[model samples]
Target: MVAPPDNDVLWARGLHHAHGGTSALAGVSVGVREGEILAVTGPRGSGKTTLLKCLSGQLVPSEGEVWFNSAPVHTLSSPSRERLRLDRFGWIDTEPHLVPELTAWENAALPLLLRGTGTRSAKHTAVEWLDRLDVGMCANRRPARLDQSQRQRIAIARALATTPQVLFADEPTAPLHRSDGTQVLRTLTTAARSHQITVVLATHDPEVATLADRSLALLDGRQSGAAAEAAGSSDEESRAACSLSV
Candidate 1:
């Protein structure tokens, strides 16, 4: 197989996946440019999450290849992929899966701590990101003590604390109100851009898609009727704003 381009942080070719004989992805191919935010937009059951999982090495494709910084990710063993995720990739799931027992700062520092960073240093970095996400005041609160949006912000803080090479966020704000989601999305893209982190954001909202530098839409587990980056006529301004870096 040809090597991925040097500037493409992540690449996938001819990706396909199936669950219990049902197709989740069909012949999907994509390239995420270095330091750029790429949106994977599609409706529910449209293959967005499956495609992301395949590309991120969280799930192996039933067919085809995945590369990370030109390394053969799909070809790696499960343990190797786990290490890759621990050391180089960060993920934000739809739910803010914070440990209920841990304080906000502690929850955000979990990843860094798991990676063996000193506790004091990890807490400092975690708090700094919590502040950036505008959740600094909640740093001492536990998950049960915070609202959905606050918990989500701490989750985002956790993902950013390590400053991983690539970040994958799957319907990250699905549980929040529109206004709350918008603000979190804005903060996420801004942080990703400022840190030069490549982001692959999965969402079903048009407004959310607008924040990405480029977008790929899926339909019934396959490419849609239009080309990649094709936006609705109403989103012209949003597309043009792609270069705004948030």
Candidate 2:
């Protein structure tokens, strides 16, 4: 397993969210250390995805704050937030977000191109990651033409192409068969560690959780009592001294 970096990469302090009267997440606080894998596991409606959105700056928290490398994500300008997300954070949703018209390689290279990398160089890096993930054969195939597992692999390859500081995956194995799901999870986790990227995954799969260095369970829009207690006890003494100085 890759060691967590000396810096804190992501943190959520007293995060809360709601939709109408329903609470999606309440007082959820967690910190993801650089280069570590933190798995969030919970039942449906447990706010795992909501927490991810808040941390990624896609959705603002209702009553709390999310910090990325000591900067409040919600306070950044749109362009700045977007640049941060693109350059430092990588997100992989359950469904593949590849463009239907673009081939897998093109889709994977899109982010790099957006960040000013030349087409040839970005495509070369994309192809290299695809090869690493064993999806090189699908490089020229459009997402519509690839099977579910192939498309998922392409999405992961795209996420890892930039060597992001933090990688978030939401139920990455939801659409795959048991064997394929395991393979994808293993590939993603291993690659993240090899690159020293912090990984935060939300899933209900026990097998997936087992791969994490730490796992937290959520229930009814809040982390489970036991999980919360453990986090408090273990993380407080070690992390409190280094809380975001800003």
Q: Highest TM-score: give the candidate number.
A: 1
Error of 1 at 169 (Å): 0.6
After superposing candidate 2, which stretches have Cα over 4 Å from the reference? Answer: 1-6, 225-246
Clashing pairs in 1: none
Q: lDDT per residue, candidate 1, 1-246, as tens digits?
A: 888888788988899999989999999988888887888888999999999899889999989999998689999999999999999999999999999999999999999999999999999999999998889999999999899999999999999999999999999999999998988888888788778899999999978887887788899899774334535433344434443343
Worst 10 residues of 1 by lDDT: 226-235
lDDT (10s digit) by residue, model 2, range 1-246: 122233778877788899888999989988877777888999888999998988898888888777887678867777888888988999999998789999999999988988899999999999998987789999999988899999999999999999899999999999999998987887787787767789889998766776676787889878784333223334334223223221
User: In candidate 1, which residue ranges exceed 4 Å CA deviation?
Assistant: 225-246
Query: Best by lDDT, which number?
Result: 1
Please state the error at residue 10 of candidate 1 in Å. 0.4
| Model 2 local distance difference test score | 0.82
Backbone-clash count (model 2)? 0
Model 2 residue 122 CA deviation (Å) reads: 0.6
